[model samples]
Target: MGLVRNRVGLPAKCDLQIKAKREVCSFEFHSVPGDKSISQRAIVLNAIAEGQGTVYNVLRSRDIESCITILRQLGVRIAWNGDELSVHGQGLRGLQAPAGRLEVGNTATSARLMLSVLAGQSFAAELGGNALLSARPMDWVVQPLTDMGAVIEYLGAKGCLPLRIQGASPLSPIDMEATVFSAQEKSALLFAGLYAEGITRYRQRCQSRDHTERLMHYFGIDIHSDNDVTFLKGGNAFCAKDVMVPGDMSSAAFLLAAYAIRGVDRKGSLLIKQVGVNPTRSGFIRLLAEMGLHLTLQAEAELISGEPVADIYCTPGTRLSSVLAEGNGRIQSLIDEVPLLAAVSAFAEGNTVIRDCGELRDKDTNRIQTTAGVLKAFGVETSCSDDEMVIHGGRPLSPAIVNSCGDHRIAMTAAVLASSLDEPSIIRNCGCINVSYPGFVEDLSQFAHIDVLPAE
Candidate 1:
């Protein structure tokens, strides 16, 4: 209950307070958005290829919608009903030049991937995005595609967006090494490799998500990876299949973190069913499990949809141990979950050192810095370098006002911290949760005391 104002005799702002319950409460069932990353890739690949394909369980987020809009501008017909999306793909040589500029707002994947394909076309196309996307580094995508004989001209800043890709003759395949560990950059090259004259091979310094490769294979595109090197030969036809996108594991991270921190009852432990559990993207889960989280993976199966799916059941369990993030697939898989994992570390017993995630430093470095700042704001002692964060754990967390910085993972992470508190904690700029899971606040309201307040 909020304090009443005596002068006006009316209620003022609502104050949220978490009360201690005698019994433990847990979540039994919950569902999140359709895989946003997968949906974006599915739409882009199917729309640009030479087949009529149906994509089911597509996420209807703002980013994905931007991709669809761009595809439509490129003369691809898209029919969508709820989560079911059908793309009448324009063949390799089927695209017509759009009359005006095509804008992709804050969707880096859409902007980057489409730029690669547009490079292979024979028309001049301009691509731009919102402030955030414009500020994102495109040189990783630009340099590789340019080396493949795509002439891209940057109109605004060097190696940034508001760029123009004047379609020139597609060049023969060239072996290149990806400098940054960005899945989008790798996928962009691979997508261009689909139309290259000869074989195109990509060697990466670090492994990123392989959804693009998995989807290409599912579409009958031959893409082979030997160790860290991926080879894709040109002159191949893509056979589209009916893809069923599972729930996004990234989105599920918040629920698992909340349940772990809040200590849900046995019966109410939220069953996040049928989520994409591709081994390449399970680093966070692996870390949590290593830290002693009571997580269960059931009905695990491989899908020809280019990704893997399984049922993830997470209930309340003992506090986890501090985990040191090692190299290999761990950093690449959980690139987006670093913030939440950092919060998880706050409750652990030892020192947690997350290292070798330098690639993440390219994008949202401020978020990483802000995450460390928030930990300090919450009374948790932490330190972070450019590429790593070391958090000393087993510290008591007190209620404090924290800023989300408009990052979805950070916002949800703050909410998870709120759930564990006996007192009220205010989260400003937390509305960014809609970037992925729009129902976050509504769904969370069922479990904890949450009041959605405007940023003051």
Candidate 2:
């Protein structure tokens, strides 16, 4: 049989099988590239703004590149010089309708966020993506846009993608109530509301990440929130501003978990300098502390960018404890870290149960199941239902080959397990690690001895 090589030249198959006995070793990793989430937003916002916008330290990943492609298709002038990106936008309400269909691949953020901007236009547009992107829920955007008078149709599953949106008369103000608190949904409504008749009000169960609201304020747009409602007035023009995208806390969780499991100094603790510590996205930090992991945050000095930057110092400590739902809910602010946090749980002393993460189940059940699968391969007992994964720890993981299931987080978690194992193990679909951390293998090489063996 032949091996499969992915776009980034990662090994086709990553299977972890014990070729020898277990050996313990430690290593350190450096910082990763610019944040993916911020990169997507930066490109979209720059495309919609009036003047030239400069984005420094932008990530050039698949998802972010999808956003850049959509922006360019809509008549924006975008240039990239190394890590610096320059986008010349047509200002609010500046985009001319594209002559044909605009395809945004694999990235739901690109499809959803850009759809909102498209809603305000006096033209028609169709949005489609890769199989996975088309499968993601779009009713989140459909419901609000339809309520505000935008015409949209789901070409596939009821609320899912393969969307055909015919731009309508600019939206009328909406006193909207959301069925779920999704940042993409909220941001979509806010973008569509920019061309509405009056003030558009957003009400949801709880607050989401708030990147949209914060960026609104940054661009001199009129926005306000009270209780559970956020308001955006129509007839507003957003000014282009230079943005400094910081390191992602979500990405930082991998390094933190590696440090906590393998002993930071023993494996050489990683320093992720000047990462975005947006309170909404720091739940992992809080949850780790609550679970009794030792992590130090330094350089809390404020930056001119309106977001806080800090140095993260993490060292391995005693087996961390499980988090309760009430506490987990408090840190639900950073829900994306739950999967990697499960890996940390596998190395903990007691049962580490994760609940109130039902939202995650809907997005990547295959990936989550892969986490449980990897844990089982390493001799960690785990129980997973639709919503949560319960782990029983304190058992040293045995060396075994596992699958990454085409998920980057899963690939990295498997790598972490491989680092602490004495025997050579295989991780199938290891190429998935390129989705987020492109240099993951190189960084992981610093921690443990890993061979890029070809698949059978």
Top candidate, metric lDDT: 1
The per-residue C-alpha lDDT of model 1 at residue 197 equals 77
lDDT of 2 by residue, 54-74 (tens): 988787666677788788878
- Model 1 worst lDDT run, 10 consecutive residues: 1-10
lDDT of 1 by residue, 1-456 (tens): 111111111012222233223245655444566788888888877886777888887776667778988889889999987679999998765688987888998777788788878988888899988776777798878987888888889999999989988765555688887777768878888888877878999998777788888888788887899999999987566755678888888877877776666643423555777789988788888888888887889888877775778888765567678988968457889988888899989988999999876665555336668788888878999988878899998878988887666566676777777777777788776544555676666555545766555446
lDDT of 2: 0.71
Per-model TM-score, in order, reads 0.91, 0.90
Question: What's every prediction's RMSD, in angstroms?
Answer: 5.7, 4.4
Off by over 4 Å in 2: 1-30, 263-265, 325-331, 364-367, 453-456
Model 1 misplaced regions, further than 4 Å: 1-23, 264-268
